[model samples]
Target: MPESLEKHGVSVLVLDADGTPIATVQDALDLLVSASYEGAELVAVPAGRFDDSFYDLSSGLAGEVLQKLANYRLRLAVFGDISRHLRASKALPDLVRELNRGRDVWFVTDLDELDARLSG
Candidate 1:
């Protein structure tokens, strides 16, 4: 299930943690269409909604999905602790750090952090 809400004046579509994993660019495009139809500027997908490949940079799943979303000009907030994935990958932490510096994509630990980032 997904919920619609407003945070920091941004209309958001929040996806449930338990759902079909977003495993490909097509899945990401579907989400973008859904968010646009819902009148949302952002889609807040729980971290668990992604497949393991999404955390593996070499797999290129993250780039494909993120690029799809960015092409549609839709913001994404992948919220939850992905510490284990971060620890396993040498490049991911730095990638996430840089990504967090922008407004298009974010990897946040929780809703509060998501709200703060959106507000900022």
Candidate 2:
């Protein structure tokens, strides 16, 4: 496991794939607290096997998660090949395209791409 940023007193969080979920909202909040405690400047959520629950990307739960991140002024990046999302929802694809043009949220294909986004 990666060392916790809490040990270094840096406000940064690297949320693993398991962090995404309708039921894990509390867990996600806890992570935000942990990140805050660590003095995190950025919180990263890497691409991985997302739970099937996330398939309902249009659901209020997903929006709630996004709202939470926005409320905290955290940059939210979902990294990985989301061709599945593109195949799943036409609206989602459009949303991804739109959000990609913004700085707050990014739908990236890889970590390198995510790094470029964060740096640029």
Candidate 3:
């Protein structure tokens, strides 16, 4: 589990299969809250490669996660290529674009971009 918050002074939690983020949306939210409580300005979630056999984005997990973040007033920065989502659903691209333009959500391609966004 490679989880740490150290990208341009922003708090980051990288979640892979080895970590606890795969369990549930609440688990991920808890982690973010914990980080925020510890004075983290931003949270980066790099969860890529969804398991086709078990996980599905259309199951409302994304909305649940976003709702939780909004409730907490925490900005979420998702890093990595989400081409699969764009290919699966056309709405995802627009959603990402809109979120990036918003105040609390961002879909970034690299740490540099994330850093720039968080900084500016």
Candidate 4:
């Protein structure tokens, strides 16, 4: 079952344990549909739900998925430790920093941080 949080007219759906890895735009679409069905404006996901390629800037999967989510006007928060990937790539940290600056997407370290963000 999906966990949820509601405050300030925003509802967030926290992806359940064993969330499926996002491999394509369709995967992101599916999550959007699911979030809509749950009446959630934001979807809180764990970083592990994304494929390795999603972290590889050359693959373009990250941009595509995030764009799809943004096009739908749904906020996405990816919570977890992505430090290894950050350490491996030169561009990822900057990408993450930029993404976090926008209201449409965020990368957080834990649920409490995500909660604080969503609450705001």
lDDT of 1 by residue, 81-102 (tens): 8999999999899989999998
Q: Model 4, 12-102: lDDT tens per residue?
A: 8998648678888789888888998998988888889888888889899999988888888889888999999999899999999998888
**lDDT per residue (tens digit) for residues 43-113 in model 3:** 66664633331124477767777787787777777777777767777667778888888868888887778
TM-score of every candidate:
0.96, 0.75, 0.74, 0.92
- Among the numbered candidates, top TM-score falls to 1
Candidates sorted by lDDT, descending order? Answer: 1, 4, 3, 2
Ranking by TM-score: 1, 4, 2, 3
Candidate 3 Cα deviation (angstroms), residue 52: 6.7
lDDT against the true structure, per candidate, is 0.91, 0.63, 0.66, 0.86
List the pairs of residues colliding in candidate 4: none
CA shift at 7, candidate 2, in angstroms? Answer: 18
Candidate 1 Cα RMSD after full superposition onto the native fold (Å): 0.8
Q: How many residue pairs clash in each candidate?
A: 0, 6, 0, 0
Give, for candidate 3, the lowest lDDT window spanning 10 residues.
47-56
Clashing pairs in 3: none
In model 2, what is the error at residue 26, expressed in angstroms?
Answer: 1.8
Query: Model 1: runs farther than 4 Å from truth?
Result: none
Candidate 1, position 53, lDDT: 93
